[model samples]
Target: MKLNLTPLFAALLLAGCASVGSVDPAPLPLAPGAYKTTAANDATALTASWWQSFADPVLDELVGRAMAANTSVQAAANRLAQARAVLGSAEASRLPQVGVAAGAGRAADPGARAITRYSAGLDLAYELDLGGRLLHERNASALDVQAREQLLADARLLVQANVARSYLALRALDAEREIVAGTVAAYGETLSLTEKRARAGDVADLDVARVQAELAANEAEALALERRRLELETALAVLLGEAASSFRLVPATWATALPAVPAGLPSELLQRRPDLAAARSQLQAAKARVGVAQAAWWPSLALTAQGGGASSELSNLLRSGASTWGIGLLAALPIFDGGRREAGVQAARAQLDGSAIAFREQFLLALKEVEDQLGALTLLRAQGEANARAVSAASQALRLSDTRYRNGLVSQLELLDARRSELANRRAALQVRSAQYQTTVGLIRALGGGWATGA
Candidate 1:
């Protein structure tokens, strides 16, 4: 039979009328080229695994463990899987749907003789997608998958950065603990000297009491440092997805070498940051949903076909003479439904607006994070240098004061003051170093694990 092509052609022509209103989404604004603060020798491209730049084998191992086992990372992975499954389902909807049906029935009216019927059939159906509703839905689902993938990346970066920061903090605490222990020991020696001088009538007994009090204070400070260290160790264990009670990290010296990161142009950050990527993906998905909603306002067309055999006897169901078949074209247009379809369109558009705003907000947040970290690192470096000088001078003063006290040229209190000053200076220096490392990790995380351009 010759097909009627005129109606099909007319439907195709009117398909464009069903499209929802759309706005061309523009890219978010970015800051001008170059960051306000970037260190010398730091103009290198960011890498995917930025943590490896630290060159510490132990840290590398810890970060790897966290990436593989951290609960947050695992959760993000699961979400990505879910998004992929949804995308698959949406894509499958775009193709024809086929199903099978089989049935046997027996019925009787009043005392009439019973009759039986048996049937088996294959049913096929497909939406025409003239308005692109299914297409838009599939596209939205695909964008969701991409967004989830980006989220997984962001989660991994956060977990690694957290582990690094915790580890560095523990190391800093270890150094401070050693300083406090030394201070306690030195105070003990001073107390011993004060006691001897008191017995020899060279110093008053009150001097000996003051020395004992200072010794006790240093011991208490040492205990506090140990407590802080334990807390950091426990936190690190959790980040590594291990039982804190069963985990222990032995004290090790902090590495002097830190990876220098170049803050690339703010425009490059749009591609480098996983969070930004995720935001953009969500925006795309929202835009697709608006199209899907707009498509709903138009009539839907579906083609259905069924073929089957029916017979009163099950054995005769497949017989050639018992065959039955039918084909249908269904078109449904909602004249009115209390404005449900219009409401859906409005809601989708509202969501699109919100997503657009969110994308911009994420961009701003990414820029702020990079700037904050860079500024902090620059100041910390200067502070670290000043702290090193203070430590050196304090050490020299402590040595001279010790000699003077032994020669009876300085009071025991003066000797204790010098010793405390030197310890304080050393601990301060260690803290500055720790901050530098922590800030560097923060910067890396902010840059989305050093995502290189075009990655």
Candidate 2:
């Protein structure tokens, strides 16, 4: 039978143009216009280094160290480098491959004189990307590199937030410890007075016992705060990539001034979050892979050319008669593989679907995080105000009880109770303040380092 390849070639060319089955991802349902708690008119965008807003030099230095040396951040950076290398390799594969080879061999037969042969050759081979397979593969690799880059950004952001929170917690603990120490000292003075009054037969021994118990309790509370401070210091050291045992943060006060963050329109959030960007990049990569899989169902064409010279003597290898050269074209069409190509196409489509869904989920998650932090800050601020009033009132009541006790107008037990209430109120106020600082950090992170109006 005489074969006519025109129709076959035409059909294959047209099939190669078919699009992948993967669907393009679209914007998902997220919070609308503006955050409920944040101002809508402020237009400043989030700073790249949001931790600087804390205005603490120690915290700033710690965050910087974490970003530079934290293990998670370092690992992510390495992954980005690897992805870039893969992308380079894929792109290079699209061009022709050329190489040179040289060899020498000696052979002897039982009834023949020994002889030597020498050869040298240059070869070139290239897969003609007539089906767009190589192009799509390279596109996928490029997207992978973008995804890895975003992942690295996410890692850095997490490290910075962790370091900030740890350092702030240590300071909060220190503040609370100071309050306990103050209470302990007050109890000590009261105990001394009760002992003197008892010796003078003006107060009973029970009064002395009560004051001693209060002093012991405050001292115990102080010890617990110290332990917590030590733990936080160790955590911060690890974040800075240093040995926990060898690292220490000097006692410092927590910064109460929280910089107001701009919460931009929800639409802009998709672009600001690194995790969302990473998900979107992965979706693009998966879509490209679908095209690659579809391309595999069609025929592949390759062009190869080689020129070489061979001779018994190395000096004569390049002589005109001893030289040789050839050119050829190769094609491969999937004949049958038990539906393997179909399975691959289905798998690629499935992966594309997964990636698209993942992108949507990531968007929703980011929105939820932002809202949660906003709500926390709002409520915590109100609670903080209430706590401030309680502390003030308790302090005034304690002063009255002390004066009355000094004049023997009230029992020692009543005076001790007043002191305890004052200490508790002070500690509660400190806790609310600490919570505000911590939640503010969370809000910044949830907003993807910061936000800008109209962003």
Candidate 3:
């Protein structure tokens, strides 16, 4: 009896695969039910178009433009497209490979006479995945495509958040410049009055000098604010993928509505962050690759066939006597190698371990960011309230001091002090409001846009 040992060898190789043990990954950090710095919960779930919640048309337009034009976002999109193409190629690999060929050749016959032959043929090959190698490879590629998709989402989120923050900072500068410009005007008026008093000998030259110094200082501050504002504008231009000189954001009232976004549960963040989703996909892909590498040690089976006709004359090739055909069953088993397959499996498992650890790190960072932004917003609200009160009190004090000084009941120094105090308070209040808007954006980004989990 004839005996075929291919099946027996395949079985033994599969058994060998069971001996390649995988290292168990360390446990992931537990997520709390709620963040330690959790705020009041709101009904707002995360949405992809989270920027619209801010209710600023200019901001909305800028974000849209940046999403379309930013180089980094474009690069991420290209990567996604490439990964999808690779996935298509992977999926197509399981299908039979077919080709057509036609050729004409001249050769010396056995009798030393020159002869010409014409042939046309169709060739086909199909690999049978008896060891699951092709299946695992396809699965790995599919998972990688998923990872690339999530990475694209992550890139968009980053660009949206940055555009919002930069625009907010620019608006804050507009408000600050308004305050400083007003102070400069007031200081200029005070200097005019002080010079008149010095000419009439009603006040000393020291008072005149102090007023002049205050006016110049306020003017200098106003100029500095303008410079900073221009820089921000230029920075924003770059964010929008334009030349700094060509992009100009007109100064306008700070009217971007600050949406109250509450911090959701910690569990929600795991599902909402694209970066985390990407890491998870990558980890799964690594696991799939390990299977592929381990499968390399097993046997592979394939089917091949070729059909053709050949004759001395092209027309004669169609005759039944000139027809030719072939079929083959190919089997391959790795009898011995210098540990290449084993090394591949080991390397694949190492990648799996790395991916798992990376996923854990990503989760930890996501949790920390959400908590950090939540805490900042919570504190910023109270700080804004206190600063507003200070501005109110300082304004009232400044009015009183101005009236008293004009009536000769107080020194000009006290009036200058009151004005300086009021300006400082106004600036502090503006800074606090700016922080509130920027922090809300941060919290929104940390929440992964509107609150729903990443798909």
Candidate 4:
């Protein structure tokens, strides 16, 4: 059987048209010599397990649990598996499809006599990729797999960072709580002494009331800090893929080693982020699709083959006289589709353009993140020192004021002011230290200094 098809210059189509699939999908590459903000030393190299740099056993354990159990990471892994399956299908499209069949039936022959007809056969079909359309499609699918793999890496990195940040912040809250608790005890002692003096007629009741107010305020602040710490712990539990009721991070010493990064990092480090790599993969997949769209302008060719045997008896199905075979090639071209092909090309190109812009935006964001974190770390370091000095001065002033108040050399108001100053400065100093820890982790993540692929 035959049907009329849009005719092509048979020779030209067979020989392959030079301009048939001519579309260059220009890809973006990271700029050479990207501003050198690399790691400081060999020990600081970005590794798959970067959380180890902190040297906190609890943190290391939690991060490990998160990487293995986080829901987002598991979801990404599922996606990667799906992408790989899709890639396998795309690859199969480029290979020969073969099948076998056997059948027996009762039928009437030309003489109108009943007959038992037995048949067995094998068939094969394949597309000849003259325009690389199928090839591009397969390549695009492969890129999708790559992108998904990178996305999996990205999910792990995000979970790791959040765990470290939340844990460190919780520890900071503990430190602050300790400071407040100590101050509360001191205030309690002072209040008791002030009340005794009031009863002895050495100090007025106003002094006792003032001490009471200060003690209550510090106690309130301590409770608020505990509330915040509980919230952080709950968030961490989710990150670790555990039920909040079953998880608890008890208050302990914050001994996580704070690692420092170096100045003027190299350009190669810029491309290490999984998110950035995923973006690049997405762009390449889009580019491959553009090529697929371009290939659509060319004709498609297919090759078919079959071998079979037929006989009146099942035993004779493969007999010498019952054998038959044939082979053929076919071609198809769409003469007109009212600009549908053109529209496809345009859509694909548009997608490619958007991907390019997205890639650029990601690159710019990467740069800004690194810079912001670096600057923050520097400013925080200096701030920590200043807060330390303030705390020291405040502590000394409070000690002197307490002594003077006992001797009646300073008023109750002056002593209370000194205590407030010392508490505020001490809390400020703790906050600065916390910022340094949190910012260091941010710097590691923002700088894309973690999770090397295929590790």
All models: lDDT?
A: 0.80, 0.78, 0.82, 0.81
Q: What are the clashing pairs of model 3?
A: 45-451, 46-450, 46-451, 46-452, 47-450
Candidate 1 C-alpha error for residue 325, in Å: 0.4
Per-model TM-score versus the true fold = 0.91, 0.90, 0.91, 0.88
The 10-residue segment with the lowest total lDDT in model 4:
1-10
User: Model 2 compared with the native: what TM-score?
Assistant: 0.90
Worst 10 residues of 2 by lDDT: 9-18
Count of clashing residue pairs in every prediction? 0, 0, 5, 4
lDDT of 4 at 68: 79
User: For model 2, how does the per-residue alpha-carbon lDDT over 359-452 read when each residue is reduced to its tens digit?
Assistant: 6677667767877787787788789899999999999999999899888799888888888789889989988888888887887777667654
Instruction: Give the runs in model 2 whose Cα sits over 4 Å from its true position.
Output: 1-46, 108-111, 262-267, 453-455
Q: Comparing 1 and 2 by TM-score, which wins?
A: 1
Task: Please give, for residues 1-455, the per-residue lDDT of candidate 4 as tens digits.
Answer: 11111121122122212232332324423333333233334335446677888889999899988987889999999999999999999999999999998888999989999999898999999999999999999989999999999899888888889999999999999889999999999999999989998999989888898899999999998899889988999999999999999999989987888776654554445566788788778877888898899899999999999899999998888888998798999999999999999999999978877776676678668767876776777788789889999999999999999899888898989998998999999899989998988888887787465423332
Q: On a 0 to 1 TM-score scale, where does candidate 1 land against the true structure?
A: 0.91
